[model samples]
Target: MGDRRALETQLAVVAGFENPQARLEQYPTPPDIAAHVVHFADLQGDVDGRTVVDLGTGTGMLALGAALRGPRRVVGVELDAAALDTARDNERRVGTTTPIHWIRGDATRSPLCVHSDGNSETTVLMNPPFGAQNGRRGADRGFLRTASELADVSYSIHNQGSRQFVESFAADEGGEVTHAFGATLTLDRQFDFHEQETRDLDTEVFRIRWT
Candidate 1:
């Protein structure tokens, strides 16, 4: 609602508030990155007055952040029931009047219902799993495909290693990378396998527009 710094501060309160279960590849998108993504989208004139969908919205950080900017509507799609419960709690705490619809479903199979607002564009924002874990390879692509199919624009965060695959996949789905930036995804030790107190992951943020 205010400046970028204020928004970041608001979103940052959600960090580490509720950690995710590891089987789901559930890591909350850090507040700073979430703020950056939302703010950048706002600056592009894509968020305000638009319908924003947050695919795999772990705890609704991105969805809530986007809602704060006064979108027409916001929907958060998350499969994990636990995460959804937490998200609902967070939404109530923030006390925002902006409508945020939380759906419990698998993002890969989720279908978007576009409510047209006189040419106001739809934007899909996501931080999908990188699929680095066993048996979950190419997970991010599904979100990308779904976003491309439904939204006019998509902003996503992925492992740096997936850069080439993402670009190529976007082109195949009738979209092109309009902008991209890199960041460090600071991951706190959530799983048993994580030995470090925190790990910094090389990540990329992409803004893709459909043709």
Candidate 2:
């Protein structure tokens, strides 16, 4: 293992975070950073009293941040049992009264209506796998399709190159990008996987609105 990888595992240990598992690579964004994203992006939840569903909400960082920012409800959908447990644990640890719910479910197949109130609009924030390998295409496609079905607006994180990767889906779903921005990521050692020690983690944050 690279020194960076070793260092990362150590950090995750110190922070009481789980080791990187399949499709759980992003871990949890630190609270400060998560708050920054919510504030800077101006992503507040339903004022009419509804919820924002966070797909792929590993460790519930995004969901918790939304709660802190005064969402009516913050719901996180995660498939990984370990990640789900960690999220639930964190919610308790924080002792938040914000009505945060962590559901053990697949993000790609979830019904959007199930996660939000009928009167309130829905927004989804997620960081899903890039599907850079050949075998993971099924997972990627299913996730996108499910996301399209579930939310009014979805903000998903992808490698900046994903702009091209998901282009074909626009035709399939009759969807268009409402907004997108490129952001650079600074990673922890756990983020160092495969061969590279330090990769320039550039991402496109897309707002895909359902018509």
For model 1 the TM-score comes to 0.95
lDDT of 1 at 48: 89
Q: In order, what lDDT does every prediction score?
A: 0.86, 0.62
Q: How close is candidate 2 to the true structure, as a TM-score?
A: 0.76
Q: How well does model 1 score by local distance difference test?
A: 0.86
lDDT of 2 by residue, 1-211 (tens): 1132322232232132576664445545544445444543344332124466888887876676555555567789887887788888877765557887788887877744654445666666676777765566545566677777766666677777777656667456867776677767655556445566544577777767665
Native-vs-model 2 lDDT?
0.62
lDDT of 1 at 143: 92
Position 76, candidate 1: lDDT:
96
Segments of candidate 2 deviating more than 4 angstroms? 1-16, 23-26, 30-33, 40-48, 111-118, 165-168, 191-199
